[model samples]
Target: TIPACNANYLPEGISEHCPIKVTFVEEGLNTNKLFQFCNVWAKHPLFIDKVQAAWVKLLMVLLKKELKVLNTQFFRNVVAEANDDRMALYLAQNKLQADPMNMTLQRRREGEILEVQKYIIYGRDVLTT
Candidate 1:
Protein backbone atom coordinates (compact mmCIF):
# COMPACT_ATOMS: atom_id res chain seq x y z
CA THR A 1 0.00 0.00 0.00
CA ILE A 2 1.14 3.57 -0.73
CA PRO A 3 -0.05 6.82 0.66
CA ALA A 4 0.14 10.02 -1.38
CA CYS A 5 -0.46 13.34 0.26
CA ASN A 6 -1.56 16.57 -1.35
CA ALA A 7 0.73 19.08 0.33
CA ASN A 8 0.21 22.15 -1.77
CA TYR A 9 0.49 25.31 0.35
CA LEU A 10 -2.72 27.20 0.97
CA PRO A 11 -3.59 30.40 2.82
CA GLU A 12 -2.09 30.90 6.29
CA GLY A 13 -5.10 29.31 8.04
CA ILE A 14 -5.96 26.53 5.56
CA SER A 15 -6.12 22.96 6.83
CA GLU A 16 -4.61 20.02 4.97
CA HIS A 17 -6.75 17.27 3.52
CA CYS A 18 -6.33 13.58 4.28
CA PRO A 19 -3.73 11.69 2.26
CA ILE A 20 -4.69 9.52 -0.75
CA LYS A 21 -4.27 5.77 -0.50
CA VAL A 22 -3.10 3.36 -3.15
CA THR A 23 -2.91 -0.40 -2.73
CA PHE A 24 -1.19 -3.12 -4.77
CA VAL A 25 -2.07 -6.76 -4.53
CA GLU A 26 -0.02 -9.67 -5.84
CA GLU A 27 -1.81 -12.95 -6.45
CA GLY A 28 1.25 -15.18 -6.46
CA LEU A 29 5.04 -15.22 -6.40
CA ASN A 30 6.71 -14.95 -9.82
CA THR A 31 9.76 -13.21 -11.21
CA ASN A 32 7.82 -10.85 -13.49
CA LYS A 33 5.32 -9.93 -10.80
CA LEU A 34 7.97 -9.33 -8.18
CA PHE A 35 10.06 -7.32 -10.60
CA GLN A 36 7.14 -5.07 -11.50
CA PHE A 37 6.24 -4.58 -7.87
CA CYS A 38 9.80 -3.68 -7.00
CA ASN A 39 9.98 -1.31 -9.93
CA VAL A 40 6.86 0.54 -8.82
CA TRP A 41 8.01 0.77 -5.25
CA ALA A 42 11.45 1.90 -6.20
CA LYS A 43 10.01 4.85 -8.05
CA HIS A 44 7.93 6.00 -5.10
CA PRO A 45 9.11 9.08 -3.22
CA LEU A 46 9.54 7.15 0.02
CA PHE A 47 12.06 4.86 -1.64
CA ILE A 48 14.72 7.53 -1.11
CA ASP A 49 14.97 6.22 2.44
CA LYS A 50 18.12 4.13 2.74
CA VAL A 51 16.45 1.02 4.12
CA GLN A 52 13.78 0.88 1.42
CA ALA A 53 16.28 1.45 -1.37
CA ALA A 54 18.49 -1.35 -0.08
CA TRP A 55 15.59 -3.77 0.13
CA VAL A 56 14.41 -2.87 -3.35
CA LYS A 57 17.88 -3.44 -4.76
CA LEU A 58 17.99 -6.85 -3.11
CA LEU A 59 14.66 -7.82 -4.59
CA MET A 60 15.78 -6.62 -8.01
CA VAL A 61 18.87 -8.83 -7.88
CA LEU A 62 16.86 -11.91 -6.99
CA LEU A 63 14.25 -11.21 -9.65
CA LYS A 64 16.98 -10.70 -12.24
CA LYS A 65 18.40 -14.14 -11.48
CA GLU A 66 14.98 -15.76 -11.69
CA LEU A 67 14.17 -14.05 -14.96
CA LYS A 68 17.53 -15.08 -16.41
CA VAL A 69 16.86 -18.72 -15.63
CA LEU A 70 13.39 -18.58 -17.14
CA ASN A 71 14.70 -16.86 -20.27
CA THR A 72 17.46 -19.43 -20.71
CA GLN A 73 14.99 -22.29 -20.54
CA PHE A 74 12.64 -20.60 -22.98
CA PHE A 75 15.47 -19.91 -25.44
CA ARG A 76 16.66 -23.49 -25.31
CA ASN A 77 13.16 -24.83 -25.94
CA VAL A 78 12.65 -22.54 -28.92
CA VAL A 79 16.00 -23.49 -30.42
CA ALA A 80 15.35 -27.21 -30.02
CA GLU A 81 11.89 -27.00 -31.54
CA ALA A 82 13.15 -24.92 -34.43
CA ASN A 83 16.02 -27.31 -35.09
CA ASP A 84 13.67 -30.27 -35.16
CA ASP A 85 11.45 -28.57 -37.67
CA ARG A 86 14.40 -27.60 -39.81
CA MET A 87 15.61 -31.22 -39.90
CA ALA A 88 12.15 -32.45 -40.83
CA LEU A 89 11.87 -29.85 -43.57
CA TYR A 90 15.25 -30.80 -44.96
CA LEU A 91 14.14 -34.41 -45.34
CA ALA A 92 10.73 -33.60 -46.77
CA GLN A 93 11.30 -30.48 -48.90
CA ASN A 94 12.50 -32.40 -51.96
CA LYS A 95 9.57 -34.82 -51.89
CA LEU A 96 7.10 -31.95 -51.53
CA GLN A 97 8.75 -29.46 -53.92
CA ALA A 98 6.18 -30.10 -56.68
CA ASP A 99 3.30 -29.68 -54.27
CA PRO A 100 2.16 -26.06 -53.86
CA MET A 101 0.59 -26.92 -50.49
CA ASN A 102 4.03 -27.25 -48.90
CA MET A 103 4.48 -23.49 -48.95
CA THR A 104 2.89 -23.40 -45.49
CA LEU A 105 5.74 -25.47 -44.07
CA GLN A 106 8.29 -23.14 -45.63
CA ARG A 107 6.50 -20.16 -44.10
CA ARG A 108 6.45 -21.89 -40.72
CA ARG A 109 10.18 -22.51 -40.93
CA GLU A 110 10.73 -18.83 -41.71
CA GLY A 111 8.61 -17.83 -38.76
CA GLU A 112 10.68 -20.10 -36.51
CA ILE A 113 13.87 -18.50 -37.78
CA LEU A 114 12.49 -15.05 -36.98
CA GLU A 115 11.53 -16.23 -33.51
CA VAL A 116 15.08 -17.43 -32.89
CA GLN A 117 16.46 -14.08 -34.01
CA LYS A 118 14.11 -12.26 -31.64
CA TYR A 119 15.15 -14.46 -28.76
CA ILE A 120 18.79 -13.83 -29.49
CA ILE A 121 18.26 -10.06 -29.54
CA TYR A 122 16.30 -10.23 -26.30
CA GLY A 123 18.99 -12.34 -24.65
CA ARG A 124 21.65 -9.85 -25.61
CA ASP A 125 19.60 -6.97 -24.22
CA VAL A 126 19.09 -8.83 -20.96
CA LEU A 127 22.75 -9.70 -20.61
CA THR A 128 23.93 -6.14 -21.31
CA THR A 129 21.67 -4.88 -18.58
Candidate 2:
Protein backbone atom coordinates (compact mmCIF):
# COMPACT_ATOMS: atom_id res chain seq x y z
CA THR A 1 0.00 0.00 0.00
CA ILE A 2 1.13 3.60 -0.63
CA PRO A 3 2.52 5.36 2.46
CA ALA A 4 1.27 8.78 3.47
CA CYS A 5 1.89 11.58 5.98
CA ASN A 6 -0.75 12.93 8.35
CA ALA A 7 -0.60 16.71 8.87
CA ASN A 8 0.13 17.22 12.51
CA TYR A 9 0.20 20.72 13.99
CA LEU A 10 3.77 21.33 15.18
CA PRO A 11 5.14 24.13 17.29
CA GLU A 12 6.94 26.97 15.47
CA GLY A 13 10.64 26.40 14.65
CA ILE A 14 10.20 22.70 15.46
CA SER A 15 8.41 21.43 12.37
CA GLU A 16 10.38 23.76 10.09
CA HIS A 17 13.58 21.72 10.49
CA CYS A 18 12.01 18.38 11.32
CA PRO A 19 11.39 15.59 8.82
CA ILE A 20 7.80 14.67 8.17
CA LYS A 21 6.78 11.33 9.63
CA VAL A 22 5.64 8.84 7.01
CA THR A 23 3.45 5.93 8.13
CA PHE A 24 2.66 2.87 6.04
CA VAL A 25 -0.49 0.91 6.79
CA GLU A 26 -1.36 -2.51 5.39
CA GLU A 27 -5.11 -2.97 5.22
CA GLY A 28 -6.68 -6.35 6.16
CA LEU A 29 -3.26 -7.49 7.49
CA ASN A 30 -3.48 -4.79 10.22
CA THR A 31 0.24 -4.08 9.97
CA ASN A 32 1.82 -0.65 10.29
CA LYS A 33 5.38 0.34 9.41
CA LEU A 34 7.43 3.53 9.64
CA PHE A 35 9.06 4.40 6.32
CA GLN A 36 12.79 4.27 7.03
CA PHE A 37 15.49 2.77 4.81
CA CYS A 38 19.23 3.19 4.27
CA ASN A 39 19.68 5.36 7.36
CA VAL A 40 17.22 7.94 6.06
CA TRP A 41 13.64 8.60 7.12
CA ALA A 42 11.72 8.44 3.83
CA LYS A 43 8.66 10.20 5.23
CA HIS A 44 10.43 13.38 6.27
CA PRO A 45 10.45 16.46 4.06
CA LEU A 46 13.88 17.43 5.42
CA PHE A 47 15.51 14.09 4.58
CA ILE A 48 17.63 15.48 1.75
CA ASP A 49 18.41 18.58 3.80
CA LYS A 50 19.62 16.42 6.65
CA VAL A 51 21.73 14.27 4.37
CA GLN A 52 23.30 17.28 2.67
CA ALA A 53 24.00 18.89 6.02
CA ALA A 54 25.71 15.75 7.23
CA TRP A 55 27.71 15.54 4.02
CA VAL A 56 28.90 19.13 4.31
CA LYS A 57 29.81 18.53 7.94
CA LEU A 58 31.76 15.41 7.01
CA LEU A 59 33.55 17.27 4.22
CA MET A 60 34.51 20.02 6.65
CA VAL A 61 35.88 17.47 9.10
CA LEU A 62 37.77 15.69 6.34
CA LEU A 63 39.22 18.99 5.17
CA LYS A 64 40.83 19.38 8.62
CA LYS A 65 42.69 16.09 8.16
CA GLU A 66 45.64 15.26 5.87
CA LEU A 67 43.90 12.42 4.03
CA LYS A 68 42.59 13.09 0.52
CA VAL A 69 39.75 10.60 0.46
CA LEU A 70 37.40 12.24 -2.05
CA ASN A 71 37.83 13.06 -5.76
CA THR A 72 41.42 11.68 -5.85
CA GLN A 73 40.72 9.00 -8.48
CA PHE A 74 38.34 11.32 -10.34
CA PHE A 75 40.98 14.06 -10.68
CA ARG A 76 43.58 11.47 -11.67
CA ASN A 77 41.29 10.17 -14.43
CA VAL A 78 40.65 13.71 -15.66
CA VAL A 79 44.39 14.39 -15.85
CA ALA A 80 44.99 11.13 -17.69
CA GLU A 81 42.22 11.84 -20.19
CA ALA A 82 43.56 15.37 -20.75
CA ASN A 83 47.03 14.00 -21.42
CA ASP A 84 45.71 11.43 -23.91
CA ASP A 85 43.60 14.08 -25.64
CA ARG A 86 46.60 16.40 -25.94
CA MET A 87 48.69 13.61 -27.47
CA ALA A 88 45.95 12.80 -30.00
CA LEU A 89 45.58 16.50 -30.90
CA TYR A 90 49.33 16.74 -31.40
CA LEU A 91 49.39 13.71 -33.72
CA ALA A 92 46.37 14.99 -35.68
CA GLN A 93 47.99 18.42 -36.10
CA ASN A 94 51.22 16.81 -37.31
CA LYS A 95 49.36 14.63 -39.82
CA LEU A 96 47.37 17.61 -41.13
CA GLN A 97 50.51 19.73 -41.43
CA ALA A 98 52.37 16.98 -43.31
CA ASP A 99 49.47 16.44 -45.74
CA PRO A 100 47.83 19.86 -46.14
CA MET A 101 46.04 18.73 -49.32
CA ASN A 102 44.18 15.90 -47.54
CA MET A 103 40.66 17.10 -46.63
CA THR A 104 40.04 14.11 -44.30
CA LEU A 105 43.15 14.82 -42.25
CA GLN A 106 42.24 18.53 -42.09
CA ARG A 107 38.73 17.72 -40.79
CA ARG A 108 40.13 15.20 -38.28
CA ARG A 109 42.63 17.79 -36.99
CA GLU A 110 39.87 20.40 -36.55
CA GLY A 111 37.67 17.90 -34.71
CA GLU A 112 40.52 16.91 -32.42
CA ILE A 113 41.27 20.55 -31.62
CA LEU A 114 37.61 21.23 -30.79
CA GLU A 115 37.39 18.11 -28.64
CA VAL A 116 40.44 19.15 -26.62
CA GLN A 117 39.01 22.62 -26.08
CA LYS A 118 35.64 21.18 -24.98
CA TYR A 119 37.34 18.81 -22.54
CA ILE A 120 39.35 21.63 -20.99
CA ILE A 121 36.25 23.80 -20.57
CA TYR A 122 33.92 20.94 -19.62
CA GLY A 123 33.19 21.83 -15.97
CA ARG A 124 34.30 25.44 -15.86
CA ASP A 125 31.62 27.67 -14.35
CA VAL A 126 31.82 30.58 -16.71
CA LEU A 127 29.31 33.44 -16.69
CA THR A 128 28.47 35.21 -19.94
CA THR A 129 27.00 38.67 -20.41
Candidate 3:
Protein backbone atom coordinates (compact mmCIF):
# COMPACT_ATOMS: atom_id res chain seq x y z
CA THR A 1 0.00 0.00 0.00
CA ILE A 2 1.21 3.50 -0.79
CA PRO A 3 1.78 5.73 2.18
CA ALA A 4 -0.56 8.69 2.44
CA CYS A 5 2.32 10.92 3.55
CA ASN A 6 4.24 10.15 0.38
CA ALA A 7 1.26 11.31 -1.64
CA ASN A 8 0.70 14.70 0.04
CA TYR A 9 1.55 16.79 3.09
CA LEU A 10 -1.74 15.87 4.68
CA PRO A 11 -1.75 14.96 8.34
CA GLU A 12 -1.53 11.24 9.16
CA GLY A 13 -5.23 10.64 9.79
CA ILE A 14 -6.68 13.57 7.89
CA SER A 15 -7.40 11.70 4.70
CA GLU A 16 -9.51 9.18 6.60
CA HIS A 17 -11.05 11.86 8.78
CA CYS A 18 -12.02 14.26 6.04
CA PRO A 19 -15.64 14.03 4.89
CA ILE A 20 -15.09 15.57 1.46
CA LYS A 21 -14.27 13.32 -1.43
CA VAL A 22 -10.82 13.72 -2.95
CA THR A 23 -10.62 13.28 -6.68
CA PHE A 24 -7.98 10.86 -7.88
CA VAL A 25 -4.97 12.41 -9.57
CA GLU A 26 -3.38 10.57 -12.50
CA GLU A 27 0.38 10.77 -11.95
CA GLY A 28 1.90 8.47 -14.59
CA LEU A 29 1.68 10.71 -17.69
CA ASN A 30 3.30 13.67 -15.92
CA THR A 31 6.60 11.94 -15.16
CA ASN A 32 8.74 14.99 -15.88
CA LYS A 33 6.80 17.05 -13.38
CA LEU A 34 6.96 14.24 -10.80
CA PHE A 35 10.71 13.91 -11.24
CA GLN A 36 11.13 17.66 -10.82
CA PHE A 37 9.11 17.54 -7.61
CA CYS A 38 11.16 14.62 -6.31
CA ASN A 39 14.37 16.47 -7.20
CA VAL A 40 13.22 19.52 -5.26
CA TRP A 41 12.06 17.42 -2.34
CA ALA A 42 15.36 15.59 -2.24
CA LYS A 43 17.16 18.93 -2.02
CA HIS A 44 15.19 20.08 1.03
CA PRO A 45 17.15 20.40 4.31
CA LEU A 46 15.41 17.47 5.97
CA PHE A 47 16.03 15.28 2.94
CA ILE A 48 19.47 16.64 2.03
CA ASP A 49 21.46 13.89 3.68
CA LYS A 50 22.11 11.20 1.04
CA VAL A 51 19.79 13.06 -1.30
CA GLN A 52 21.46 11.60 -4.36
CA ALA A 53 20.98 8.09 -3.03
CA ALA A 54 17.40 8.89 -2.16
CA TRP A 55 16.85 10.30 -5.62
CA VAL A 56 18.14 7.11 -7.22
CA LYS A 57 15.79 4.92 -5.21
CA LEU A 58 12.88 7.31 -5.66
CA LEU A 59 13.55 7.47 -9.38
CA MET A 60 13.45 3.68 -9.64
CA VAL A 61 10.14 3.51 -7.82
CA LEU A 62 8.76 6.36 -9.91
CA LEU A 63 9.80 4.59 -13.09
CA LYS A 64 8.28 1.28 -12.01
CA LYS A 65 5.01 2.94 -11.02
CA GLU A 66 4.72 4.75 -14.32
CA LEU A 67 5.64 1.69 -16.35
CA LYS A 68 3.04 -0.41 -14.60
CA VAL A 69 0.44 2.24 -15.25
CA LEU A 70 1.36 2.40 -18.91
CA ASN A 71 1.37 -1.37 -19.28
CA THR A 72 -2.13 -1.62 -17.79
CA GLN A 73 -3.40 1.15 -20.02
CA PHE A 74 -1.82 -0.20 -23.17
CA PHE A 75 -2.87 -3.81 -22.62
CA ARG A 76 -6.30 -3.10 -21.25
CA ASN A 77 -8.02 -4.14 -24.47
CA VAL A 78 -5.80 -7.14 -25.13
CA VAL A 79 -6.77 -10.48 -23.63
CA ALA A 80 -3.32 -12.05 -23.77
CA GLU A 81 -2.18 -13.51 -20.46
CA ALA A 82 1.06 -11.89 -19.34
CA ASN A 83 3.25 -14.80 -18.36
CA ASP A 84 7.01 -14.36 -17.82
CA ASP A 85 8.01 -14.95 -21.44
CA ARG A 86 5.10 -13.00 -22.87
CA MET A 87 5.72 -10.07 -20.53
CA ALA A 88 9.41 -10.04 -21.43
CA LEU A 89 8.61 -10.01 -25.13
CA TYR A 90 5.94 -7.35 -24.71
CA LEU A 91 8.24 -5.11 -22.69
CA ALA A 92 11.06 -5.61 -25.17
CA GLN A 93 8.77 -4.72 -28.06
CA ASN A 94 7.51 -1.66 -26.22
CA LYS A 95 11.03 -0.45 -25.44
CA LEU A 96 12.12 -1.00 -29.02
CA GLN A 97 9.11 0.97 -30.29
CA ALA A 98 9.55 3.77 -27.75
CA ASP A 99 13.32 4.18 -28.26
CA PRO A 100 14.80 2.42 -31.22
CA MET A 101 18.27 3.74 -30.30
CA ASN A 102 18.35 1.76 -27.05
CA MET A 103 20.73 -1.16 -27.53
CA THR A 104 19.33 -2.97 -24.51
CA LEU A 105 15.87 -3.05 -26.06
CA GLN A 106 17.26 -4.27 -29.36
CA ARG A 107 19.20 -7.02 -27.60
CA ARG A 108 16.18 -8.01 -25.55
CA ARG A 109 13.89 -8.20 -28.58
CA GLU A 110 16.49 -10.22 -30.47
CA GLY A 111 16.82 -12.62 -27.57
CA GLU A 112 13.06 -13.06 -27.27
CA ILE A 113 12.70 -13.59 -31.00
CA LEU A 114 15.47 -16.18 -30.90
CA GLU A 115 13.77 -17.96 -28.05
CA VAL A 116 10.51 -18.04 -30.01
CA GLN A 117 12.31 -19.47 -33.01
CA LYS A 118 14.00 -22.12 -30.87
CA TYR A 119 10.66 -23.08 -29.32
CA ILE A 120 9.13 -23.61 -32.77
CA ILE A 121 12.15 -25.56 -33.97
CA TYR A 122 11.91 -27.90 -30.99
CA GLY A 123 8.30 -28.79 -31.97
CA ARG A 124 6.83 -26.74 -29.12
CA ASP A 125 3.54 -25.04 -29.82
CA VAL A 126 4.17 -22.42 -27.14
CA LEU A 127 4.86 -19.51 -29.47
CA THR A 128 2.74 -18.06 -32.26
CA THR A 129 5.29 -15.42 -33.41
Which runs of model 2 end up more than 4 angstroms from their true locations? 1-72, 123-129
lDDT of 3 by residue, 1-129 (tens): 652332333211101232333456655576554434555665678776676788899999999788768757895522233244555666677677679899987788878766545544667444332
1-129 in candidate 2: lDDT tens per residue? 456445543211111243344455544565678866664475689988988999999998879453333435445545456556666766876676578799998788777766667654787412111
- List CA RMSD, all candidates: 22.3, 21.2, 20.0
Highest TM-score, which number?
A: 2
Task: List the candidates ranked by lDDT, beginning with the highest.
Answer: 2, 3, 1
lDDT of 3 at 25: 60
List model 1 lDDT by residue over 73-112, tens digit each. Answer: 7766454554554454444443444563787755754554
Ten-residue stretch with the least lDDT total in model 2: 9-18
Candidate 1 TM-score versus the reference:
0.26
Ordered from best to worst TM-score, the candidate numbers read: 2, 3, 1
Candidate 2, position 108, lDDT: 81
lDDT of each: 0.51, 0.59, 0.57
Report the C-alpha displacement of residue 100, candidate 1, in angstroms.
Answer: 44
